[model samples]
Target chain A: MKVTVRYFAQLRDAAGTGSEQVEGDFRTPADLWTHLCARHVFPLGAADLRVSVNARYVPFEAPLGEGDEVAFIPPVSGG
Target chain B: MFVLQASPLPGGADLLPPGDLACGGVVVFEGRVRDHNEGRAVTALEYEAYEALAQAEGERILAEAAQRFGPVRVAAAHRQGLLQLGEAAVVVVAASAHRQEAFAACRWVIDAIKERLPVWKREHYVDGTRAWVACGCHHHGPEAP
Candidate 1:
């Protein structure tokens, strides 16, 4: 399936862009993260991040569908 | 009102819900960017947000605060992009029929925003180094060596 991945903060800095389209046979967000980490060398692991599918917080195991929008949230520090 | 903007945040008074005569007390909380962190002299900070989710979660926090505290008007605004030292990075305003409720609701909203909002901060130090600010509370697994 194909999905659009969005990155924020440090992840965006590592990825060198805010977002990208990825085509893969990914079954879940964790799988996607594994793939992206290999490609972008993200500084943090999935355990330190949260996954949002279609803008709603979900587990890394959340299933991904075609054309879905996914974002990896790093440890938040907003006040 | 919950929003994330690239421009400078408005003053606390401007964030309050206008013309609520029944409210006897209003609380405004402005979280400013500090000049130093962990003994490092900071020059500026950069904030980024997953805009849609951040706004949605922020609005939910305000709504929850009102429900918990009763009859309170709450609003919040967070700053995106770069901010200098001492700038108001966030402003939360809450008004209620009583002083206690207003104060409690304001505090609740800001805390919830910090815990739940999908926003990130990057600190720029005077030594020409920058690092992302991690709250260190979200990680549930084993710590790295």
Candidate 2:
């Protein structure tokens, strides 16, 4: 399946871009992030991040479908 | 009014909802970009968010806040992009039939934003250095040793 991976904050800085597309057999959000951490050398652990699939916060083990929009949420610092 | 603004949050302190006989109290809170942080002379801040998720989460929080706080109407706005010192980075307002619920809702929304929202803050210091204001758990920068 083809997955679009998005980076934010430090993850974006490390990867040099905010988003990209990947083609792999990754079935879960954790799998996709682990692949990116290896490919881009992300500084944080894949398990340490929060993820949302299709604009909704979900568990790391949430299943990913083809052409899913996944977001990696960093520790929030808003008001 | 859970919105992700790309520009400055002007008049944030005055953004409130219309009051009626039903509401006896209104609470407003603004999160400003302070001039200093962590013993550093901070000049500016950069706020970034997963806009889609941020919006969805923010709206959800507003819905939940209303349900939790009896007879309260709440709204929130968070800024994105670069913000100078003293700018209103975020604003939240709650109006309720009584002071207690309004106050509680105001506090709850802001606290939840800090914890649950997907936004991240990057501190730009005056000494030509910048760092992502980490939450003590995540945010290992580009070169984490």
Clashes of each: 0, 0
Best by lDDT: 1
Q: Give the lDDT of residue B37 in candidate 2.
A: 72
Query: Cα deviation of B145 in candidate 1 (Å)?
Result: 29
Pairs of residues at least 3 apart in sequence or in different chains that clash in candidate 1: none
- True-contact fraction in model 2 equals 0.82
Cα lDDT tens digits for candidate 1, B82-102: 999888888989998989998
lDDT of 1 at A76: 86
- Model 1: runs farther than 4 Å from truth? B136-145
Worst 10 residues of 1 chain B by lDDT: B136-145
In terms of TM-score, the best-performing candidate is: 2
Q: How much lDDT does candidate 1 score?
A: 0.85
Estimate the lDDT of model 2. Answer: 0.81
lDDT of 1 at B122: 91
Error of 2 at B77 (Å): 0.5
